[model samples]
Target: MRVALFTTCLADTLYPNTLRATVRLLERLGCEVAFPEEQTCCGQMHYNTGYREHARSLARRHNEVFHGYQAVIAPSGSCVGMVSELYPGLAGTPAPTYELTEFLVDVLEVTDVGAYFPHRVTYHPTCHSLRMLGVGTRPHQLLAAVRGLDLIPLPESESCCGFGGTFALKNADTSTAMLADKMRQVLGTGAEVVSAGDNSCLMHIGGGLSRLHSGVRPVHLAEILASTEEDPWLPETR
Candidate 1:
């Protein structure tokens, strides 16, 4: 199957490592993956910010670039959710798209990932993805299958990380308040790293951990799944 990688603007510029990890993981799974350069932002940022026209143009561009691929997989729940659910609403058009884990478990049907990380980890599901995409427990299926990885379920796995695109800017105070609770939930788990598909949320959560001098770090799901015990950095037991 020909799969296209929909690396969003944030993942493309702010968190390039996540996109690279995605490419590495998919290639190892024996699927042919291609990067479509024309694809940029899924217009989620604009759409979520009340800019319908700009979002429409972005949605159109995204669909035009992604149409024929067997599946378009992205490393972000936010962007994938935008393309799959929100884009259709904005542009009155829909196309096949998969958040990385969804594609891995549903399409690829293998979760061993051929990579191992000995870290005790937790997953944070961004709001749009947890509800809009209705991908309940499927992402966890892949996380649980990784060899040597102890996947601890978060207490409120469905809570938002509070990075609602421009919601951060418009209501910074509210955003931080929400983030505080999310960070607390993550810390409560005592996991070394918190993993999630959307870097925007991880970016917010990671900043909180840094400000508090907490030991926990926020990592993208792609990064964790692409790692292996060969690094020797992984804790021997966790």
Candidate 2:
């Protein structure tokens, strides 16, 4: 199947490896992935911030850029939620959008994409993926199939990491408190890494982990799924 990659702004800017891993994993699964350079932000920031007109403009551009693809896939559930859930109201028709795990499990019909990551990893279901996209068990299914990966259950895994785009900045105190709770849960798991579908949430959680000088690392689901024994994903320095 041929698909267009909607590399969300956060992944493109801060976590290019996640995008690269997404492409690699898809190509390994016999997919022809294309990156439409004309693709831009999904205007989620604008829309969530109450700039509906600006969001609509970008939504139209998003549809225009990726109109012809059989499927539109993104690594971040946050942006996918924006496209699939809000785009209909913002733009005329919402693009056929699916979060990476959703496309892999539902559309592609494969869980084990021949990945290996020998580490204790816990998954955090971001608000958008859980509440908005309802991407439950899709991520878990894929992770369970991964060779050498010890998937530990995160305590209160569905709780928000307090990074609701602008929510972190606007409600800094509340965000930090929530993040502190999240960090405590992550540390309790004794997992070496915390994984999630959205980098924005990972960034927020990672910041707390780093400040605490905790050895735990935040990793994207795409990166974990993309890893193979021959070409393994090296852990980032804390």
Top-scoring candidate (TM-score): 2
Q: Could you give candidate 1's per-residue lDDT for residues 1-238 as a string of tens digits?
A: 7788888888887887788788888887887989988877888778777888998998888888887888888887777888887776777665578988788877788767876778899999878778777777776877887777888889887877777889988989999999999988988998988988788888899989989999897888888788766632231121
Taking all chains together, each candidate's TM-score versus the true structure is 0.92, 0.98
Tell me the tens digit of each residue's lDDT in model 2 across 55-141: 999999998998878999999899999999888887877557899999999999999899999999999999999999999999999
C-alpha-based local distance difference test score of model 2 = 0.93
Clashing pairs in 2: none
| Residue pairs clashing, model 1 | none
lDDT of each: 0.81, 0.93
Q: Model 2, stretches more than 4 Å misplaced?
A: 236-238
